[model samples]
Target: MAYWLMKSEPYEYSWSQLVADGRNVWTGVRNYQAANNLRAMQVGDRAFFYHSNEGREIVGVMEIAKTAYPDPTDETARFVAVEVTPLMAAVTPVTLAAVKADPRLVDFSLVRQSRLSVAPVRDGEWAMLCEMAGISA
Candidate 1:
């Protein structure tokens, strides 16, 4: 299965919110690149639930529950969204500071393309991150 990372602002939608909701449509992506990433996602692919902006950490794991579909929020009908289900919350949220400090994660998209809200995660990096979050890879 492919691995991915998706960011959401804590104030807007926190990890706790996702857990409470059980499942949700991951929409509102305006960026072209982020939209492309969303389109590329498939059902059952694992993803890191990142708390962006103030929180700035990977707070949980999620799985894509639905493939790309036309976004209802888009009046132009140009974008798409996927549905995601919560898998697990991290024992210790992996902060951006922690990621930047680790040499093993230096080349990660989270570092190289910090502005990206949706990005691909390599298998090795995914394994290491799972370890950091106190979960089995």
Candidate 2:
């Protein structure tokens, strides 16, 4: 299964909100690369839920509940979205600072491409991140 990291602003949609809502449609991607990442997601693929802007940390995990579909939020129909269900909250949220300091994650997309909202995670990076968050991968 492919691993991914998806970012959401805390105020817009926090990890707690996802847990409460059970699941949500991950949409509104405008960037072509990020949009492609959304389209690449398949059902059952796991993702890290990163709280961007305010917290800048990976707070939880989620599973892709549905494959990509035309985004209802986009009138142009150029974008797509996927349904994601909360898997488990991280025992310890992995901060950006911690990630930056870790040599193992030096080449990660999160570090290489800070502006990307959705980024692919390599297997080794995923394993290390799960360990950092105190979660079983």
Among the numbered candidates, top lDDT falls to 2
Residue 121 displacement (Å), model 2? 0.3
The CA lDDT of each predicted structure is 0.94, 0.95
TM-score for each candidate, following the candidate numbering:
0.98, 0.99
- Clash count, one per candidate: 0, 0
Per residue, candidate 1 scores C-alpha lDDT tens digits across 5-116 of: 9999989888899999999999889999999999988889999999999879999999999999999999999999999999999998999999999999999999999999
lDDT of 2 by residue, 1-137 (tens): 99999999999989999999999999888899999999898899999999999999999999999999999999999999999999999999999999999998999999999999999999999999999999999
Cα lDDT of candidate 2 equals 0.95
Could you tell me which residue pairs clash in candidate 1?
Answer: none
Over all chains combined, what TM-score does candidate 1 have?
A: 0.98
